[model samples]
Target: MPIRLATTADLPAISAIYAFARTQMAKDNNPTQWGKSHPPLDLLKADITAKHLYVIEEAGNIGGVFAFILGEDPTYQQIDGAWLNDQPYGTIHRIAGNGKIKGTFSKALAFCEQLEPNIRIDTHQNNKRMQHLLEKNGFTYCGIILTEEQAPRLAYQK
Candidate 1:
């Protein structure tokens, strides 16, 4: 699989992957993380333009999307619990699978690890799947942190 920077032309597939993610999150009882208007096209366009958005192609198709931001994440500055280290980190946000593909997080993590080992990620308290994926992939819980929207999320670091 090759992970590449996302472009405007990839919006349709990215939107579809996120739609599947929202539905799955709802079904898993984590309805508050992403709402109906979340990850809006405009926001994605901004990510693409900012060079933060990435897409992973698997088996000749776009199978995953995520935003990898380097540096201190403002929302993570106030975690209730301490981080494992005070080193610089990269934050992985808005990771979503293609619905038809498995191990999307694994692929994204592998890609991120190649660039930076000290990584951070967060998920809704109710997103058990993601929590498991994080833990299974070597992330340690760092307690709750609030998003810019004032929503509390379970933070983790690796």
Candidate 2:
């Protein structure tokens, strides 16, 4: 799988993944990080237009996506616990996998590894699957952070 910068044309595929994620988030009883209004096609277009989203493609199909930003994340500054890293880090938000697509996490993880050594990701406190995945992939528990919506998230860093 190869991860590439997303384009406006990828909105439909990305939204599909988010739909599945919505169900998972609901099942986990976590606050909707993306909210019901997210992936508004227009929002995705803007993310693509600004080059903030990346997609994983395998066999010419969109398999996974993760929104990320370079440099220190403002949210990190407000961590409720000590972060694993005191250095600069990249922050990954809204990572989702198309349940119909295989190798999703593998692809996204590979993409993250290629970006930088210092990477941080957070998941809703109820998102046990994601937290486990992050730990399995070498990220250490960092702290909790409240998103823009004021939802608490368990943070991890590598």
Candidate with best TM-score:
1
> Whole-model Cα lDDT per candidate?
0.92, 0.79
Residue-pair clashes per candidate, as listed?
0, 0
Q: Per-residue CA lDDT of candidate 2, range 23-50, in tens?
A: 7677777546656655567767777887
**Model 2 C-alpha lDDT versus the unseen true structure:** 0.79
Instruction: State the RMSD for candidate 1.
Output: 0.9
Candidate 1: tens digits of C-alpha lDDT, residues 12-64? 99999999899989999988789876898898999999999999998879999
Give the clashing residue pairs of candidate 2, or none.
Answer: none
Q: Which RMSD does model 2 reach against the true structure?
A: 1.9
Cα TM-score of candidate 1: 0.97
Q: In model 2, which regions exceed 4 Å deviation?
A: 39-42
In angstroms, the error of model 1 at 8 is 0.7
Model 2: residue 22 alpha-carbon error in angstroms: 0.8
Quality of model 1 by C-alpha lDDT: 0.92
